[model samples]
Target: MATQSPFPFLDGLFERIAQGPRPPDWLVNEAQQRLVLLINHVLMQERAATERLIPRKGRVVRVQWRQFFVALQVTPAGLFDLAAQGGTPDLRFEVTETSPLGLAQAALRGDRPPVRIDGAVDFAGDLQWLADNLRWDIEDDMARVIGDVPAHTIASVARSAAQALRGFVRKSGAAAGGAVAPWSGNGPLP
Candidate 1:
């Protein structure tokens, strides 16, 4: 848990979106921000879990863009497009992305997403620009979103949630028990 700043930007963004005519520039910025954070968090967990499952040896099969992953589908581990740079995938799998907080609330009520995996990750130094940095340690929601194929809708939703969480984390800090930055330590993002 880390402290965050109030995401007045996101709040205002959302408010603007909700208000009426949408601004194209605002929407584009929102989409980029959304993808950056969603991909980062998922990859963060995926990285941790993968490290534990795949033994460090000669080399783990680097899943290409369309490689066979799950038992049923011949697909990549997660959702990806041909435009997405990488070796051609062998297969594809469905993905349903539940927000961290949303998933927790769901668990409390006993309403579970078809598949679920959990992990505690230290995400202090992760960047949002790496393609091969997905976290496999956490459960892949891919298989759960769609029955036989990766759903584009889920990816979109996941991206949105990721952006919102990024905004929240940026605005708020770790609860009351985590790390603390100095008043002047908040200089600028590296």
Candidate 2:
């Protein structure tokens, strides 16, 4: 027998909310710039990551998720900067899933949503390499601001909370006939 989702209400609510008008261009642009800063910070932490992109300098990669998109150009400094013009992208990735809950769940489980690609195979391969190889040390970043001990403590506590949340989701999934596997990289509802 087909079963109903535990989060049917939330699913409907999210779907309705998503139908609303998009954010303003200025807001979107600001958000994209902040995202670029965060990405650049992480890249700077790992020399090898930027080094690999040296040959791909000046190439533009566009990433799209629903109505939002960012076009990045590889800089001579081996980092990413916003693309100057909406010119042809050397590589493009379009995220298939649009549900906010689904994307959040996949992220919690350390999984990537399925994406459709259009453009250079080599550039795509480079991006895949970045995804597979690069990881940011959040605790280390925190340590630079706060002391190492305090940063470690905060990181540990945060990690514990996340683990607890994951455990709760898993148990809820099992108890509800496996419906709430949000962290399992499954559909948001089932």
Candidate 3:
């Protein structure tokens, strides 16, 4: 039996919105700046992440998703600086999935969105290492400003909320006749 989408109207609405006019350049730049700021904050937690990129200083890496793109250059300080000129990229990553719904589903299942890569093998390896090892400890960062006790309590609640949300998503997916792939180990791929 063929299963129908639980929210066909939402699916169509998303498609239409995605096809609509792009945001202004300034807005896009602001969004990119905010994203970079967040990434830098996360990077601050792991000194080794920046240190590994030191040798790649001045190298440009371009990452693209849908119509949004950010070109960043590795600085001598080992952090990323936006390259407004967008000179030739030493490494480029383009997200293959175009549909917002599909990407959201993948994320809910803790799966990585497929990406097309174009870059030096060594740089790519280093990037992969950074991805695999470095993780932002949001609770630890919060504790720095809010004190350990409150931060721990907040983090615990946040974690529980996240787990509940993930469970809801999985159940909704299954009820819709869709399989939610596991992040790792066992379970069939969607």
Best by lDDT: 2
Candidate 2 lDDT, tens digit per residue, 1-190? 9988898777677767767678898998899899999999988988888998999999999999887889999999989999987589999999988888878766665568989999999888888988888888999989999989999999999999999877776676677786554456665644
Off by over 4 Å in 3: 1-17, 175-177, 180-190
lDDT of 1 by residue, 1-190 (tens): 9766587467477656544564476664465456545644564455553343233212112221111121211113332212233433223222243344444434433354333222212221111123235443222455554532455556667768877755544444354233222235476632
Model 1 clashing-pair count: 40
- Clashes per candidate, residues 3 or more apart or on different chains: 40, 0, 0
Q: Which is better, 1 or 2, measured by lDDT?
A: 2
Relative to the true structure, how large is the alpha-carbon lDDT of every model?
0.37, 0.86, 0.84
TM-scores of the candidates in the order shown? 0.21, 0.81, 0.78
Error of 2 at 48 (Å): 1.0
Candidate closest to the true structure, highest TM-score: 2
**22-75: candidate 3 lDDT, tens digit per residue:** 889899889888978887877777899999989988888899888778998888
